[model samples]
Target: MIPPSSCGVLVVGSGNAGFSAAISAAQSGAGSVLLIDKCPESWTGGNSYFTAGAYRIAHDGLASILPLVSNVSSEQAERIDLEPYTEADFARDMRTVCGGRSDPELSRVLVEDSGDAVRWLARNGVRFWLSFNRQAYEVDGRTKFWGGLCLRTPDGGKSLIADLQASAAQHGVTTSFSTALVDLRYQGSDGVVATVRCDDGRRHEITARAVILAAGGFEASPSLRSQYLGPGWDMAYVRGTPYNTGDVLELAVRSLGAQTFGNWSSCHSVAWDASASTDPNAGDREASNEYTKSGYPLGLMLNAEGQRFVDEGVDLRNYTYAKFGRAILSQPGHLAFQVWDSQTSGMLRAEEYRPERAEHITGRTIEELAKACADKGLLDAEAFVRTVHEYNEAVYAHRRENPSARFDPSMKDGLSTQSSGKRLSLAKSNWALPLDQGPFLAVKVTCGVTFTFGGLRVDPQTAQLLSPGGGKIPRVYCCGEMLGGLFYGNYPGGSGLTSGTVFGRRAGRAAAAAAAAVEEEGDLVRS
Candidate 1:
């Protein structure tokens, strides 16, 4: 006789992924599924709680699923350029990311099931902004393209997690909040996840047939952040609360000896240091622009030897990609600068982008900006001035081309359009003034990123969690940023939500099936 001590399914997390798994397993007749979140009820991390909650699904491909949403505001959405990278193209990119180590079957599953994920959300009362840029994603089939809607649950919620939490309740899933899962225990079968322990020094024994870990990444854990992402970088989570501690990921890898991918990560460049010191309404994407040595865009980066590297005027994302992820007090260079002009000053003033108490480098001349830096103990004023003088001269002499001598037109535009300190074009400074404008501005900036591009390897089709041995980990699943090694390290917006839906569906289906199969064999609760 099976003891009453065991749950049919134990889900370790309360974020979107964990909630989805619990709800799916419960719906699939798991009898009972318990969700354990290490965080307090209001503060589950993993990017879901404070996420804009806008998901993207195919635009015209699945017109049938279009009518399911109850309410969506196309106007309220961030309508980005959806440049299409086709199914094949996406597969190729993913394959490269995984270094050709992914299962093709899983990839296909993710592509196919992703559509249904949107529909499932609709059926659960989630909504999406209907009017989308459908033609945008089809342009090149390799560029960042997506023609989809911005999704949210009804009544203007703050994030997708709230909607999911409420839905889990509606579906009768049990919740254990503020409970951290410290370890994973398996029964006789290594394939089966048997139990999870809470960090409260209490052992909540799990007699479940399956366990789903939706715990988040290492963004919030300072130690983990330094260990995985590199040191000396302050995590600027300007938005979401700090609660996720990577407990589940630790449980999976360190405890279970599982495999992981996507060791490389990026900070989204601007996003690493840009958030609400001021209202974003006025700051927008322009607030994080790079600065000239005269303070045009202020990212002045140096290497370990204190040698100046990268021109901040270059694409910020490039630095995030190539730089960052270094040791504390010992990165290639722990410092960078952001410089700007009068127009940038106006932008910051319009929104008070800089914190009211922060010291700023404002000058009618580069000498003054350097002096301001010295006043703040940032660097020697003389050396700083000379460095900028030399840099600008090089930029003026075609050492810095209109489009980076190394970057494509789209990449240049993509980067330039996003940064504010950098001129829209090096040639035009209001077509009237230049970085030489009196009262130039500069701000010492920090370079750090939140998550890496590497994560668990999976089969997207079945949403099957794979073992390091290249075999499926039975009764296991992954979604969200935990999806690693796909795309090799590059990311596209909306892809996270896309994977969540796609693999979430597969995980839900598979978990339910696992429960049912065990019941048929008289190994689990038949209910």
Candidate 2:
């Protein structure tokens, strides 16, 4: 409930990045910081509230990260086989996933500052735990954490928002919900003036010495999706907040001449429940990220035509899941079915695959499963069964040649269909175990867009929005999904939240310093 008058720093959006900037600004002695969001207080955290809150950081194995988490017991720690994730490893993933097009400067900052940013978040109020359920596998009574992702907020993004909000309030930052930023302009010596519309339809202008925009991308806007992300994207279900319609981002570019960067045609999408609500505004708040069916890496995905459209085991789930949504969308009906035998059904994450959270179809045999999938809109029942049989045959042939090869999800075991003399048009690169075990489970999925990869370009060091002319915009900073060029085609799991924290902290500090400098200049004039 702040008056539409003046403040030292103004922040748009109330998600993790916004709160990170607000709290950082307040802590840095920026007086009268105000945070505003277009949605009501119920929709406070924006898309961040729907995330797994995973943070990927470079560390020295279990010993380096053990101090930052609260979930690992002394006995549990001893049995954990955690490997160190260095900056080089992180950078290599960024390059490989993005096809070597990720901005080197932004990637460097995100990787180098990730550890310190995570530690800073811990120093504030955010709590982290080992991502045991999502990133580890138990082999021989020992937990082996795979994929460089190890830490996540307990209970996922909900707890992340709660902790960040608490920290912001403690730091004297005020929040105003249902306050949408309509326009932004720099007034030179008078600072940045933002025109905002309140829920009551009242419009007013607020002046701030420095302004930070962290309002997220335009993934929720169907028009923008169809326009930028290409055809059929308008039908993609949104996995996060519908309120992030790119209002502030558009405002920045239109009014401030902010430079746009990165791949507008790609986004952080995933395999989502086909039964989930299609209405962008109607995302199940309780279900949140649980709608994601990421168990494909452990099994196979067939399109409506009953053909394998992707190499499900091409890489770890962290590396492949983001781009697979586009693959799923390109299929016949923009839908696919993930099938797993009894052998790997238990490996699926309970939070995502529990019957209460997701719809599951089971059958006693491959033929029965195919029939059931046909009932659920599969185009060809016979092809579905044939595909399964062919996959099983390939797996068996590979195993016969290389009996030493074993299916281990903890690492990229060389157990692949390609190892066999016979080959299918598409091959499972890893975790290729014959799916001949008893009853099988299948889940229907479609594309659920998480966020856009394209956004305003910002300086990697200060997070200040880069003007089209190749300079920083005066006193304006940007972070989170609104600042682009770090991710292009795909991103490693858990890097989004870490990148947000890194640049959010940078933008906050830079905005606060700008505000202080403005105040000092005014003080000198008065003196």
Candidate 3:
């Protein structure tokens, strides 16, 4: 169906950010809100449909969020240990992970508004749940939630999009699928004119008092990846919707002179299943986020050269997973193996590492595991065996030096492979254990790019697009991955979704107010 030629607010993209903007615009009294997406109806939520749905927010404690989630019972809540995540904690994480390059104002807004944004999501029909499967570990018979992430939507991103879409519809927002934004031109007080291509291969012009661009980044574009993120990025697997080809971003920059910001050479990449398809459009929507291979934090990773290249336990998986994909891509053949012993095999998230979901190579001993890896593509089986032996010795020496330092996955329990007596060239900083327990398991992984970090700069308060010349564009806004400067070299897991909602809501309300002002001016002119 062809969309109407005009609207109070026109939102491009049908993902979480777009839905948030459309819903908020209608709820904020925008007379007519329209949302459009380049993807078909089946790809309704875009990249958000493939997320684990984790949302990082600052809160008082478990009790603070208990009222919003449905997954925990009174009995379960008693056994759960959750510490308060303060605004300072969130800010520190952003600063640390982004290497102090994240935009100050953007990071501050995201940190301060995170909790309220999550609560707003719950109030708008999105069901919440404690992320026990991904964020918690059993310690001393108690469930300890770690990594400062505790909440998610049930069924992950699938339910998140469903609920948000329902809310948008309930608010009388109209949606058009298979509609691509071709160009956008801001007209100051006259409003904005957008050219869009519909599914029938027809082009139409849409005039709106305000426009919100949430059309995602350029991760799926091979040429853009190679150009912006440097070489070898084009080979990385596309983890989400292939439709985010950066068309809207490019148009905004070319036609509207939107200023781009943040780290263009970095992205939210992760260790993905090596067997996953490389074709941009061939993502297994049914399998969704299960293609992730994030169990490295519980084990160790070895490249084909059979060497431990990175500290797997440098921090919680949330902090390291996003950047490890780059490390893996730099390894030989862009491939690596994650090996775990029986001691920590059960701790792996079943959704990602279950035998049926992941192809695991197992052997009764470390040497046998190395041989199995050799068959898969390990260039040096002997080096693989020697590396394990050396790591085991270091772990043993450290254990002897500090016998009281117990292994704890719930916190940064410094059971590292470093001591006065022995130290590996690269140390596992936490949860280090000897790979002596058999049968050992290994899974091959390659880099998977989730989204790019480079995008248009927008005002932190209003989410309005900022001009290259230094002022906000009159009636234009941006949200989601399209609004850059929040992330840099790496990302803290679950923060992307939260940032999207925070900025999306802001852009929506601001656009609605702008539309109202335009309508008021027209009324006065007519009178």
Candidate 4:
């Protein structure tokens, strides 16, 4: 437990950005750097612990064989690409996705140093996926391992979070969890923080030299959501734990005259929650058409009104799938059922939970499975049968009338969730499970936000926090989503891991340099 009067480079939140900031601040040479979060060490701090850890680096080291997507003269890709993609094309695609607000320098740093950043993790005693021993960025689809990080081995951010925590301990960085930040005290016009208040109904008045607001977004604050996102709207907070409360943002504004942005905006997330494994055919309903056409495509989605609003079968980024994720929260019971057809192709198989073993699957007579699910207490079976029939009529009518609709030709890709070779195509067939299938299945799903997207804003080059009037907040630095624009809100697939690593290092080295300077001057010297 940290004493009420403790001081140093104070860091808030224990998620990815917070961890990154704390470690970076400590290395920056700040004396007595402290890590504090709203939750105890026992529970997960926030969504970062459950992320996929996919960092997008445009080209996975293929600059040579292929011209850099930008200038033909560039070298092969990252030299480690297990999958095929060009850096230039990836950059173009991301810029296009960002609709132009992404900071160029930040993006450049992320794309350029992402590999080195992951390698740094390897240097920090973090576990590698290769312990079982196949290999890495040298391969294509994977990179630095998270070990038994936060969750199990497969997911990425969990390990990154775990690594940060362990590294903090090894470095002698002090941490106190389950403590809430209630206010921030600015020392002078330079915008330096002098102290912080806590929610233990007490205040922590210390002579802190710097502070990093790694406190996560307000996705969990129902009041904030109602005030900012929408009245009926709530975050997918239930998708994971609820440590994020916009505590820093709210506290900063309410107390220290801190300026904040992105409070009114909420990023896109996934809208399906597969509770109740009782539906024997549950696995099939999760892959969207993009997954069906590609491999591991996500399943179909429907709104509360039982109407398919999105393509229903496309892969990630077809349209900010995150926006549709909000659709999950808007549904009745904040849940909707993802249904699937009995496609004999083993291609749609999900290793997470195998559906191939269901002998009860029927290829026709759609409502039979609905009755079964209702009997199993998963849905109002009769209503489910009706919903399926309506979906079939819509599909048949659309195909007959507009067979040549907007779908891209490659949507028919015979393989991969990220498209086959070049562009990651979007597929809508995830919506095409004909009601004729007899043993159809449904799984309830809710909004699944990968992680909170908002936090502090930082200067591009220095990675330092900025004040409301729009100037750098001296002595205060932030990186990762804790800063801004790198993720650029909707996420470009793979940027999270990339941003965390890049920003983490920048903050670390900067913090280290700062600490060294402070010690030399005796300004932050020991009492």
Q: Provide the TM-score for each candidate, comma-separated.
A: 0.68, 0.99, 0.98, 0.71
Whose TM-score is higher: candidate 1's or candidate 4's? 4
Question: How are the candidates ranked when ordered by lDDT, highest leading?
Answer: 3, 2, 4, 1
Instruction: Look at candidate 2 and give me any clashing residue pairs.
Output: none
What C-alpha lDDT, on a 0 to 100 scale, does residue 271 get in candidate 4?
46
Stretches of candidate 4 off by over 4 Å are 3-8, 58-81, 84-86, 128-157, 187-201, 235-237, 254-258, 274-299, 317-321, 331-333, 344-364, 372-438, 449-454, 486-489, 515-527
Q: What lDDT does each candidate get? A: 0.50, 0.91, 0.92, 0.51
Candidate 1: C-alpha lDDT: 0.50
Candidate 3 lDDT over residue span 1-527, tens digit each: 78999999999998889999898899898899999998989999989999999899999998899999998889999999999999999999999989999999999999999999999999999999999999999999999999989998899889999999999999999999988999887665667998899999999998999999999999989899999999888888899999999999999889888998888889999999998764644467888899999989888999999998999999999999999999999898999999999999988998999877788899999999999998899999999999999999999999999989898898899998999989898999999989999999999998999999999999999999998887887888999999889999998899999998999999999999999999898788889
Model 4 is weakest, by summed lDDT over 10 consecutive residues, at 144-153
- Alpha carbon lDDT at 461, candidate 1: 57
Model 3 ranges off by over 4 Å: 186-189, 278-282
What's the C-alpha lDDT at position 268 in model 4? 43
Model 2: number of clashes?
A: 0
